[model samples]
Target: MISFPFSKTPSVYLKGERLFLREPQWSDYRQWANLREKSRAFLTPWEPVWRDDELEKSSFRLRLRHYSEEARSGNAWSLFLFRRSDNVLLGGITLGNIRRGVAQSGQIGYWCGAPHAGQGYMFDALKLVIPFAFSELRLHRLEAACIPSNLRSVRLLEKAGFLLEGTLRSYLKINGLWQDHLLYSLIEGEEQRRGLSVKTTAV
Candidate 1:
């Protein structure tokens, strides 16, 4: 069964054709750890250096607690990607840094397991999440930043209708070093303009 820690929230699950976005559970620690470990080398260059206890159950519990607060407060939603066919945990996607009122926008970040890379799963996940960001979350814009050298990420964002906004010099620390990133943004209804099907249901 799908479990949402933030069960009181009206928007807890987002469903798509092949994958579903759901809240992460403490029981997912083993699968999450194994996938991250196998994808460490493939993921490190684009992500922060893993802490010594990065895969520990205690660390994951802390992470879940922090994000649970973020979700309930309408500040962010950090969801794990899972294949609906067999309920396999593929990776994660986060719509963070949410701003409301005058500036209705949020930034998105995502990753896929090494074995699942290049399989268009992230693309499908983005299709599901973007609509939720715009409709359920009532955000007007979504932003993403990626290392310039990470061509796959750049392509994924562009293919999903995000426009290249510009470059952010020394934008974020990745794998222990400051790295520049190319900024991308997608406005409300931009995906439709780009001709990508946005078929999803949020409940």
Candidate 2:
């Protein structure tokens, strides 16, 4: 009963054992907005300030459009994470700010709904996407930054084979304040060195 992209579209889709990552669709507005709104308190500390209309239907439509364009242009790939068992929307992850040429790298960011926070769903999604980035996208490195206090994110990146690179002061704005972030990176082949393998379904 799991539904996926019927054919190769401009946007890419990746599937894993327990979850799938795919391009965001406008019809997902209600579920996306509801989960985000309910998880606001749990997520706010680690996220940027939300606009007044951040979760409105109109805003979601615009966001969908942007994800489409980013995927098409090779600038970024924004994907929604869904549970495979029931297709429940679990969270979102973006491999964005892609750079080509000499620097084959991109930045990654992700979030999970509060109700699903402690589960390993996000971890599964990462395993699915990393191979797509390294093998299919043919990128050499992936980077991520997280607030120092966001211990969960730090562990997740490390568990996925990313090494601690350093820190950046006032690196990003979050929850209306400029914050310091610990930077991490994963290079090709690092996964195997760390005893991790990227599992993914072809797009």
Candidate 3:
């Protein structure tokens, strides 16, 4: 198992060669909102219906508060992806619904700005975060579910070493409709066996 330095902050920051993952900050509101606004049409089909105020600054502050609470309580980790060279926001990724004790597991989810999709940024971010999930978080397994029609997501998970488990019938409400999802999972040792490695620093 890989070892990571302890962080005094509520959330850990992950740095990779091409990009980095850090918890959202108040200063990120403008970039985040702009990306989401431009990608709304691209993302809405696979995501839940957006609230009326979804892109408003007030809504963003609420989201930050919720993220902070989740991180402090160890319930989840929410991070935004940024290109290392320019520090541009690429999108967001999350490790949520964490369970401890008998079930040391969590679910993974991610999104990319429309402009950044299919450019391999999400994959790089996954290499960093997946190892952190297994090593630093001590998670036994990680799960992800996506609409069957989202071929890009399917490929991403498969490439990242998540094995397809099965189909979930009407698993989640996406874009205002309850839709079936393809379930995938990766256990702790599986990722290492795939030879996935990326040097990461947590701060």
Local accuracy by lDDT, each model: 0.88, 0.87, 0.92
Q: Which candidate is the best by lDDT?
A: 3
Name the lDDT of candidate 2: 0.87
- Runs of candidate 3 exceeding 4 Å displacement: 1-9
Listed in order, each prediction's TM-score against the native is: 0.93, 0.94, 0.95
Residues 1-203, model 2: lDDT tens digits: 11324542466668888888887888788899999999999999999899999998888888987877777678998899999899899999999999999999999999999999979988888887788888888899999999999999999988888999899999989999999999999999887677677666654
Candidate 3 overall Cα lDDT vs. reference? 0.92
What digit string (tens of lDDT, one per residue) describes model 3 on residues 65-174? 99988887889999999999999999999999999999999999999999999999999999999988988889999999999999999999999999999999999999
Instruction: In model 2, state the lDDT of residue 88.
Output: 92
Candidate 1: C-alpha lDDT: 0.88
Better of 2 and 3 by lDDT: 3
Please give the distance, in angstroms, between residue 133's alpha carbon in candidate 2 and its true position after superposition: 0.4
Candidate 1, residue 84: how far the Cα is off, in Å: 1.4
